[model samples]
Target: MAERKATNKYYPPEWNPKDGSINKFVGQHPLRDRARKLDQGILIVRFEMPYNVYCDTCKNHIAKGRRYNAEKKSIGKYFTTTIWSFSMKCHHCSARIEVQTDPQNRDYALSKGIHRVLAEETKNDTVTSTYSMTGDEKQDEMRNDPFKRLEHLQEDKEFADEEKVHLIDLLEFRDRLASADYQNNSALRKSFRVILGLLLQNFCKD
Candidate 1:
């Protein structure tokens, strides 16, 4: 068994040192089965799905990170970036699926036998905007009105001042909590114990 796994491979009768290497002498690629499609410029590769997709034939969900033994080949070029295509079969059903690299969009695209599962946007998913001008009309009106601009500037300054005061208060509160005087207090310790006991009671009830 150890001999079978040895790095020193047994050379065939026809193999000669002048022939360069055993793989070249036998006219077989070092990758063996993986290089079967070498003539066609395709190589067998282990590919993982970049995003969630539904198998078109079976209508089954093939999740993102699902892996498959796929045939990988260069399909095209996108500004010096080589676009690759991966062809694989769905494990649920023997349906062929083709995925291609989308360099322009910096993502992957389904070419055949699979449909992308697009997540629906929700209110919570929407980004919270920072500015008060929620629309183009309001922005245009604000730009035209000097008084509104001055008011906006005043509001920004007030908000900044409030935030600064709040941050300072928080830091002072933290400092007070961390003080040696606070740590040495038996009254605070008893209060904390009572609070912890109440919390535990509430947690156990839940």
Candidate 2:
């Protein structure tokens, strides 16, 4: 883990000044609790310990007195987009720790080990969905069934070739999720969750 410097000397090409505005999407919903649990592994409480501080290198005790700056940034490549906080400067040492926080509740600390847990859950979801697709044999059978085949063909004809390609791209995203090694990567896991959520939301709407 890199040290969280108070000043960001350089911005990566992918960084966007406008990306911060996306945090407004968080809102109250029946699904919000479930989503938070899926991402963080516990039901988030409103009134709890606000911020936790730790030495980044040794993971030792650090003074809780000093306040560090909180920056919201988008991370992960594919299936996730986490707007998480980066805490800098341990009072005990010059170490910096990066922590995950709920965008809705900026002060609360998500459980320490929730990232890998969520990643595993996401992997299982992808595997289950893929397995349900039933391989080429079932697809062939579906093609042979008169009514089902008509419906399938009708849907294909209704969508342009580019739209069909986009659908394939979406399924490929599932493949990416299934293939990822989430054990060592909390950030990747977060990104995957966000991507999966966005893809599913778009798919359901379509």
Candidate 3:
């Protein structure tokens, strides 16, 4: 009798469609904690194989295939929203990794916690560095200063030239609007009204 043919069966690994595979590269960074407070109560844990996972105590890369533990817990509140904190422990060196994510959006980035006073101070510094005076106040200063007045006149000339070009274009458009006979056709009049509104908006922007 002929020998029975060998039989083989193959089975594919199980995968969940809802929760996809974790990307270790993106998850390795500590999540921002401030985001959790701004967002509602949702959080996402991301994981990936580390290209450079240095040990906290020894400053060496954590070995691959080693198991690590991650923990998430509610920390405190910012305003009415609750903040959550996460920590990961390295299996080799007992190093603790910490990150924070927004509770509202799992992908939201965490921001540094700064009070309103500090934020205002920071903005003030930025404004002072970039601009010497406010718009109307600066114009008044230029009026009083001869050298600044001359500079302002030159700027005004440049602005007038740009406005002249825009006016020419607007005149051409008005000619087209006048040439179109909308008196006999109601639809044409409606279309002209829409175009006129757009042109007026453009003029306002200028």
Candidate 4:
């Protein structure tokens, strides 16, 4: 039985690594926690693109709504969080794209060559913007760029947060809350609790 078992063992004949049956598992290693470990040595984050990105060279599309295995790099540090830059190469054209983090608004902006399409903006608007951009101009209209200038936000500045929020929204929330009688109305009580919970949640996070 031992002799038969030994005889049944199969070894490759000469140099036959290309053989499918024997080489199926060869060089096929599964990576564990690849998304988290993609930052390599840097303590960066990993996120999939939220929108499709266009490759300038090949005129191809890198679809969004999925994790592209792209590594997010830290460009600078804020009070408690680090400002990040997410970058990836276009699959078709191999063009490098860099998207930076917006500090104040907690959003992202294209630091290099890419654009996010909003529901409000139309195809014509994008076409006009493309035509208007002559020399690979950077886009950071709504972005909070800390390195753009030497001073902090003021009324003279263009991208100022303007009291940290719009006045209309402040008035609206204030009016709604003022009208609500939480002591007498069950709905108002529930809403008050929910709003209190949200405030606490955001405060703890900050």
TM-score of each: 0.54, 0.22, 0.25, 0.36
Candidate 3 lowest-lDDT run of ten:
108-117
- Cα lDDT tens digits, model 1, 61-176, are 99889999999999989999999999999999989999998876556778999987765622132346775324557667789999988887898899999899999999998888
Q: Model 1 clash tally?
A: 0
Overall local distance difference test of candidate 4? 0.60
Model 1 misplaced stretches (Cα beyond 4 Å): 1-6, 121-206
| Model 2 alpha-carbon drift over 4 Å, by segment | 1-49, 56-60, 63-65, 76-82, 103-206
The most accurate candidate by TM-score is: 1
lDDT for each candidate structure: 0.85, 0.50, 0.53, 0.60
lDDT of 1 at 114: 93
lDDT at 45, model 3? 46
Better of 3 and 4 by TM-score: 4
lDDT of 3 at 102: 54
**Candidates by TM-score, descending order:** 1, 4, 3, 2
lDDT of 4 by residue, 32-124 (tens): 344445446343345677566665667666677655546666678778787887777766666787777766544566677666544454233
| Better-scoring candidate (TM-score), 2 or 4 | 4
The regions of model 4 sitting more than 4 angstroms off are: 1-40, 43-46, 117-206
- Candidate whose lDDT is highest: 1
Question: Compared to the true structure, candidate 2 yields what TM-score?
Answer: 0.22
